[model samples]
Target chain A: MAKHVLRVVAVVYVLFLLVLPVALIVWRTFGDGLAPFAEALTSPSALHAFTVTLTVAGWAVLANTVFGVGAALLLVRHEFPGKRLLGAFIDLPMAVSPVVVGLALILVYGRFSPLGGLLESWGIQVIFSTPGMVLATVFVSLPLVVRAVVPVLEELGDEQEQAAHTLGASRLQSFVRITLPGIRWALGYGVVLCLARSLGEYGAVAVVSGRLVDQTQTLTLFVEERFQNFDQPAAFAAATALALIAVVTLLFTKLLRPKDRSDGN
Target chain B: MAIEVRDVNKSFGTTPVLHDVSLDVAAGSLTALLGPSGGGKSTLLRVIAGLERPDTGTVRISGVDATRLSPQRRNVGFVFQHYAAFKHLTVFRNVAFGLEIRKRPKDEIRKRVMELLELVHLEKLADRYPSQLSGGQRQRMALARALAVEPQVLLLDEPFGALDAQVRKELRTWLRRLHDEVHVTTVFVTHDQEEAIEVADTIVVLAGGEVVQAGSPGEVYDNPANPFVMRFLGPVTEIGGSLVRPHDIEISPDPVEGGSPAVVSRVVRLGFEVRVEVEIGGHEAWVQVTREQADRLGLGPGDTVHLRPAPGARSLVLAL
Candidate 1:
């Protein structure tokens, strides 16, 4: 009887934390009618917001993938002065609040800042623009990919690489053939996490984005604006879209990632 | 090809592992680096293979100065203790890896790989991955892979250490025949004296990062360099008066001085001989007598006997 009660409590705990919130969101999204969902999705503002969000998210994810893999490979394969300090700094953005990321981005790219003013002269405005939003997203989600990859890269010993070299492979050839295949799975996982985090970023991009309708505003900001303006159905529609995208991306990752070797295949 | 290592010194952060270690392996000869674990045998092999750099000295293979060359350019084949097979590749591909990396023609690679597999008698399992093979089969595959490159030198680091006794014995015999067939300069690293004696033309005994002795297997066994080599190489028993082989003492009704009175503790029949354990000076000493001697004397346990060292079998080892 006690064991049964424990199992019930554990399931209830999961439902309270996970299932309940999803259930509430689904209920809220479908509460009104199909017309509200269709109308909200077809709006020019919604379409603009989605396009801007995708452009920013796509750029942020791409930048993070390159920089994160570079950082991870450096931390794993090489030793230099202050290497541990450099590694700790990679995860610094992750530990900080997203709001802090926005603030830092603004401090570095605000109009008063040297680079920002220089870019402004070139008419390439960063702060309060789409570039600012992408920069903020990248800053906030930077360490997610690195953290996912560095440990796996570290666990892979130099033996295979050495064997490749001894087998007459050049350094680049060894890396391309032997080392790359060893870390490809981890790289895929890291990229998925980077994309997901960048797509869902809110506070960082919100602070940097000007929130102008059909301009710098992102899908997340559009949802927030709709909710505040009492456009409840529109807000649910945007939330449902984000949720759908996240679910699909996660499912794709699950399907495509290599099968778990622990399953004894 | 002959490998000449001169004054090779290696230190791991100030703790010297191999100090001025120099050895010569003549062409087409099998030399066994016989030593206890941590005696720098593996380090020396690594130095020769170019996996490790010597602090000072030179490794030359057939007149090529190999000190500055990388492992790949050294043209030396290495078989690791655990086999170190590429877990993902098939046996044929594993053997073909060196040739493939060398950018050899595909037909040549296939022919060479098949020939090596045939040499090891594993041609049928060409398509099977390393994980599917047995331990002995994996070792043979490793050997075949090492041989596939047609290397200038071959180094094996305790190749049969992980196998069962029967498998080890079989492989040791097979390796001796393989060396004759391949006619390559080979160095086998092992702490096992029996394996060294049974496999190699020359046995180099190492202790504390230095070569204590190097000679033919029979010479090293018969005349050890020191007490360390003596005790390390063979099962030694100490009697009260002197160190003697179990076969040195005879069963006779004669009591001699420089000899002692000992009580027979136990009698063990060893088929061809009887080993009699005697308690002398509060310690047990084993004495072996042939079956004829034992039968002539009617000797058994709990019989008091006078122990005398045979002059012919008595040899003194200077204590280190």
Candidate 2:
């Protein structure tokens, strides 16, 4: 009897907090027989926003994957000064508000700053551009891969790596052959999460991107602009698309959960 | 190839693990570094394998200085206690790893890997992943994987330490037979005295970061350099500043002349033998006797007896 009550309570809680809001938005999106949904999503500005979101997310996930794997290896495998500090800093983005992150990036890399001026002189723009947007996305999602890979790396000790070394494997060869494959599922899970977060990130990208319509606008920003302009149909359609993407990413994450100890086929 | 270490000293964060240690292993001979845990046995084995560099000494493999060489360049095979099977590869690929790294021909790799798998008796499970194998099977696979490269030297750090006693014994005998057939210069670290005795032709006794004695198994067991090595090898009773093994001391309740008069303090019945601990001249000495002998004597606490060394039995007396 108590178990049934708890189960019903959980169902009700999920219905209100998650399912109801999502279902309403989805219903509102398809209420007009899919015509407005297709027309709003197929617009020039909406399509441009989507490509921009994909571009930023692509670069951010790539950068985060490389940096996260390296940081996890260093944290778990080596001992040095300030290792704990570095680990704690990797988690800073998750703790701090994304808006603050955007402001911090602007403070350091804005056009008037020294480093920004240097980079601008080299014909590379970092602030209020695609580079700044990628930077913000990368900073916000930096800890995902590292957190995913660190525990797995710790559980997987250095014994096999030493064995590989004794078997005459070069350092790169051992990492490519042994270390990377060992962390495949965890890495995939992290990548999926990072992609999800990058696509949905708003405050940080808003501050860093300057919110140029059809230029640096992302799908998320497009939704906000459409809704504020009283174009609720387009806004609801974009929201439903993002919801679909998040659901897909959730499914991927479920499948990529690192439970099985795989040694290849 | 032979191995030589000269005055090797190692310290981890100011704590010395191996100090002034020197050793020499003959070519194609099986050597065991036998000692208690934390006695630097594994550290010394790693030093010779080029996994750990010595602080103030040199390591030579087949006359080549390997002090600064990386393990990859040293070409030594190392096996760990936990059987470091590549969890991402099948048994066949795990055995074929070294050959593949060396980029041998595909056909040759298959033939050599199959040969090693059969040698280790894992050919039937070649397609199985490490996660699907038993602990003993994984360890056997690890050994075959290490031997695949035909390394100049093979080092094992407590290779059977994770297995049960039955499997450990089986692997010990198997290792000896395998060494006889392959004859690669090998050095294994083990804290099991009986294992070192039963498997190794030469035993190097280590204690507290130093090599106390290095000789044949019988020599190290019969003649220990200090109390630590004496106690580390096996159980001994201290009598008048001399250590005598239980089987070395003879107990006679018939008042034998020239023997110390003693009282039987305790009698313990272990498997296959009865241990009679006797107090002799205010010193404790253990004597081993058969069950029938113990029963006939009816020895118990407070019984008077005479204790003396058995004929031709080696007793160790450490100078204080």
For residues B128-165, write the lDDT of model 2, one tens digit per residue.
99989988999999999999999899899999999999
Runs with alpha carbons beyond 4 Å of true place in candidate 1: A27-81, A114-126, A129-135, A150-155, A212-215, A252-265, B239-253, B256-262, B268-275, B279-284, B288-314
Off by over 4 Å in 2: A1-5, A258-265, B318-320
User: In angstroms, how far off is B221's CA in candidate 2?
Assistant: 1.5
List TM-score per model, in order: 0.87, 0.97
lDDT of 2 at A152: 87
RMSD of each: 3.4, 1.6
Flag clash pairs in model 1: none
Best by TM-score: 2
Query: In model 2, what are the clashing residue pairs, if there are any?
Result: A263-B88
Q: Residue B229 in model 1: shift from native, Å? A: 1.3
* Candidate 2 lDDT, A107-223, residue by residue in tens: 999999999899999999888799999999999999999999998899889888989999999999999999998888889999999999999999999999999999899999999
